[model samples]
Target: MALLEIENLAVEFQTSTGPFRAVDGVSLKVDAGEVLAIVGESGSGKSVSMLAAMGLLPWTAKVTADKMVFDGRNLLGMSASERRKIIGKDMSMIFQEPIASLNPCFTVGFQIEEVLRIHLGLDKAARRKRAIELFEAVGIPNPAERLGHYPHQMSGGQCQRVMIAIAIACNPKLLIADEPTTALDVTIQKQILDLLMRLQTEHRMGLIMITHNMGVVAETADRVIVQYKGRKMEEADVLSLFESPKSDYTRALLAALPENATGDRLPTIGEIFKGAAQ
Candidate 1:
């Protein structure tokens, strides 16, 4: 069975100008042990859609869907209390900015231990032990010693590793990573992505990878959904999508890949489309 399912989902925000639909008529599914990649430029609603699904969107955002189910339950109709219980236990998200997401006032150990306390109901000692294990699992060096360090003390990569530790603390069935490698150097980005993939396969979790980086998608995803302007441009298996993209937008993105850039000036999407039009 699909771990997550959404149909005709729409999300609108009450902006100053008017109601702006950030996500429009989107539909997709994620199955157990599968890596589903949502690729789009910023403000394309890839992150917003998943946030809405997790009931994390603010009150200003109006979310609706014809159908939304997770683990065979109706997420569209579930109560907030029920949703809260499932969010940390059954599903968890690793947000975009790692350091920004952590509470500056607390130690990394405390922040991650909170997840174990709340969801797993682990005792203080147990929480500490589990947090150390999670830290090590995420490749954080000196896992036991570093847990006491505050967000400011850790590097971007370390902060992200802490975030991953918290996200997987409960061994959730679904893991959503929203630009998990955003500000890291190229070397760290690969390490972070590799760690996430390892955890996902090890736990047999359904993974949703949201990013604008086609390179990450190409290396990790089993299936890919290309989005533009809050709508799906195309959906296909990773190999097929890269080998022969159907939509012009998808084709343009593939064309503008760093590997495909040969000349001094990288080709812009508009330029590619304009040439096609000509």
Candidate 2:
């Protein structure tokens, strides 16, 4: 069975103008030890879809799905408490913004320990030990010392590592990384990706990587899903998607990659379509 599955998932937000549908009829599944990449431009609902599945949307957002299952449990049918029991323990997410996601007032150690305490029922001493081990596991230097530091004290890369440490603390079966390397330098981005892949391999966890960067998809994904305008445009194995994309939108995305440039200026999606039309 797939580690996670969602069918006909949709999310609509109640805006001042009207109800705006952000995700429409999106469906996806990821198996254990597989890396699935969801790629799209900004405002394509890539992050919204996953957030809906995680039940993280706000009250103004109306989320509905025909079916949403995780590890054989029906996520759509679970109560708040039941879902809470599963969300952090069985499934975890590394959010887009590391520094913003963390609490400014508390030490990083306290925040991660809170997760362990709530889900695993670990005592104080055990939580601290596990936190140190987790920090070490994610390649943070001076793990014990870093635990007491606030999010602001660490560099962006280190803060991101702390987020990874927290996400994997409970040994989740699935991990959703929503643009985890956003705003980081290229070097830091590569390091974070490598660390994530290493952890995913070690734990055999299903990984869903939400990203707009084609390079990230090539480096990490086993399969790819292309989304545009709140709908799925194409789905294929990573190799096939790159070599022979079926959808024009996917082709346009590939064409926009820097390595694919063939002229003085890279072609925009409109230019690509216009040239094809001519």
Candidate 3:
């Protein structure tokens, strides 16, 4: 069976101006041991869709789906408490900002061990050992000593490694990374992506990478889901999306890539879309 599947999914917020739709009739399927990239511009609802699916959205948000399943289980049928048990254990998320996501007051080690204690029921000593192992696996140097440091004490890359460590503490079957490389240095971004790819393969898990960086999709994704203004524009394998994108929005996104720029000025999204219509 597919690792994750959604049909006729939609999310809307009860905003001051009435209902504001964030995702509309979206459907997708992710198989076990697969890499799926969700690409879109800011406010395109790529992240919101998954957040709603994970039951992380606020109570004010209204989410509906004909079907949403993970590993043969129906997510839509489960209660919030029931879903919570599955989320950080069998399923997990890695956020865009590692430093912000982590507790500033807590030691990095404490935060990571908390996952193990809650999900795996590991004792203090065992959790510590497992936490260190996770840190090391994610390529954090001197993980044994660094575990005692607070979020501010480490660099951006180190904090990200900590986030990954915590997310992978339970060895999740499905991992959703929302703009994981957003604020990192260019080199660090590549390193984080590579680490995620390696972990996904090593653990044989389903990985959902949400980002606007089409280049990252090319590097890591087996399939791509393109979104625009809360609507899905295209779903294709990496090669097909890059080689022959069907949607004008997809083409505009590809045109906006820095690597594809040829002239002194980068082509704006509007310009690309307009040119495509001609």
Candidate 4:
């Protein structure tokens, strides 16, 4: 069985207009020690789909799935308390915005230690030690000193690393990174990506990377799922998807990438067709 299996997952929001389908009948799987990327433009339901899978969607949202399984357990049938128990230990998510996710008043060590204390049931001293080890493992320099500093004191890359440390503190089987590199510079982005890859190799963790940046997907993902307007347009291995895109939407996204897009222009994904275009 797959490590993570999402079958016919659907999500809706009851808005002023009516019930809007943000995610419509999406299904995917992630095996152990593999990186799967969900790539699309903004509002494509890439993030919402995974958020539903993780049971992180807002209370106002309505989510339904035929089967959402992890490690042979059905997520859809589980209680909120049961799901919460599995979240940090068996599955963890590193969100897009580090600053927004972190507490402004607490030090980085305190934040990570909280995870250790709650998940691992460690004492204060043990939690601090584990937090330091986590920081070091994520490549934070002078982890002991850095531990005492708040999130605002660190650079974007460092804050991201801290988030990573916290996420993996309990050695989760699955890690969901939602646009993790969005706030970092090019150099820092590379470092963060490399760190994630290295940690995945060491821990043999399944990864779900959600991003609008195809370049990042190309570098990190083993398989790619292309979404447009809450629908999946294409799914293939990384090489095959890049070499020969089948869908018009996929081809148009590749075409929209600029020649010198590294530091300058971000690629713009093409609009989804209402139907087959002439």
Candidate 5:
């Protein structure tokens, strides 16, 4: 059975201009120990689809998902209290902006420990010890000292590592990372990906990496799900998707990427969206 299954998922937001379907009908599966990449532009519904699955969408948003299952249990049918227990234990999410997602007031260690305490029922001492271990495992140097520091005290890369630590704290069966490396420099991004890949292998967890970076997808994904304008464009194995892209939108995205990325002509992503860029 798949570790995570999302079938016929759709999400709409009731805004001032009537309802907008942020996520059109979409279906996807992530098997055990698999890395699935959801690639698309900012408004392509890649994030919204998964957010709906996790029951994290705003109250104003309406979501309908058929058989949104995690480990064989339907997520959509569960109560909010029941879902809360599963979120940080059986499932976890790493947000797009680690800096913004992480709390400024709490120490990094406390934040991680909070998840452990709530989900795993660990005592203060045990949670503290486990939180420190998680920090070290994610390659944060001087984890002991770093643990006491607040989010604002760390570099972007360090902050991301802390976020990773929190996500992996309970060794969840599935990990959904939404644009995880979006704000980091290339080197730091690579390191973070490496760490995530390593943990996925070690834990045999299903990983969902949602990002616009095809380069990252090429490096990590086993399967690929391409989204465009709140709809699924195509789904294929990583190599097949890269080698013979069936959709024009996927091909256009590939074409827009820098061949050499020379001079000032870094490619603009706006071209792939079809609508006029401001």
Candidate 6:
């Protein structure tokens, strides 16, 4: 069975003007030890869809799905408490903004320990030990010392690593990384991607990578899902998707990549779509 599955997922926010749908009829599946990349431009509902699956969307957001299952459990039918029991223990997410997502008042170690305490019922000593191990596993230097540091004290890359450490602390069966390397330098980006891939391989976890960077998709994804304006545009294995994108939107996205540039200026998706319409 697939580690995660979704069918006909949709999310809408109650805006001042009216209901605004952010995700519409999107469906996807991820198998254990597989890397599935969801790629799209900003506002394409890439993050919203995953957030809905995780039940992280706010009260104003109305999420609906025909089927949402994780590890054979029906997520849509689970109570909030039941979902909580599984969310951090069996499934985890490395959010888009690591520094902002972390609590400013507490030490980073304390935050990580909280998850362990709540999910795994680990005692203080065990939590600390596991936290250190996780930090080490993610390649953080001076893991024990860094535990007491606040999020602000660390660099962006280090903060991201801490987030990764927390996400994998429970040895989750699935991991959702939403723009895991966003705003980092290219070197750090590569390092983070490598670390995530290694950990995913080691744990044999199903990984869903939400990113707009085509390079990231190429480097990490076994399969790709393309989204545009709240709808799925295409889905294919990574190799086939790159070599022969069936959707014009997918072709436009690939053409926008720097390495694929063929002119003085890269053509925008709008321009490409407009040309196709003509």
Top TM-score hit: 6
lDDT of residue 185 for candidate 3: 91
The clash tally of candidate 1 reads 0
lDDT of 1 by residue, 214-257 (tens): 98998999999988889988999999999999988888888888
Q: What is the lDDT of residue 196 in candidate 2?
A: 97
**For model 3, what is the alpha-carbon lDDT of residue 268?**
88
Model 6 is weakest, by summed lDDT over 10 consecutive residues, at 269-278
Taken over the whole model, the C-alpha lDDT of each candidate is 0.93, 0.94, 0.92, 0.90, 0.89, 0.95
Q: Encode model 6's per-residue lDDT on 27-146: one tens digit a residue.
A: 999999999999999999999999899998997799999999999999999999999999878999999899999999999999999999998899999999999999999999999999
TM-score of each: 0.97, 0.97, 0.97, 0.94, 0.94, 0.98
User: Could you tell me which residue pairs clash in candidate 4?
Assistant: none
Report the lDDT tens digits of candidate 5 across residue range 1-278: 99899888889999898999988889999999999999997889998888888889888899987778899998888999999989978899999888899989898888999999888899999988898899889999998899899999999999989988999999999999999898799899889999999999999999999999999999999999999889999999999998998887887677678873545866555554453322
Candidate 4, number of clashes: 0
Write the residue-wise lDDT of candidate 4 on 45-123 in tens digits.
Answer: 9999988988999999999988899999999999999999999889999998898899989998999998888889999
What tens digits encode model 2's per-residue C-alpha lDDT throughout 1-278?
A: 99999999999998889999999999999999999999999999999999888888996899999999999999988898898998878899999899999999999999999999999999999999999999999899999999999999999999999999999999999999999999999999999999999999999999999999999999999999999889999999999999999988888888988888998999887677567556
Query: Which residue pairs clash within candidate 3?
Result: none
> Clashing residue pairs, candidate 5?
none
Give the distance in Å from residue 84's predicted Cα in candidate 2 to where it truly belongs: 0.7
Winning candidate number (lDDT): 6
Query: Looking at candidate 2, what is the lDDT of residue 100?
Result: 95
lDDT winner, 1 or 6: 6
| Weakest ten-residue segment in model 5 by summed lDDT | 269-278
RMSD of 4: 2.7
Clashes of 2: 0
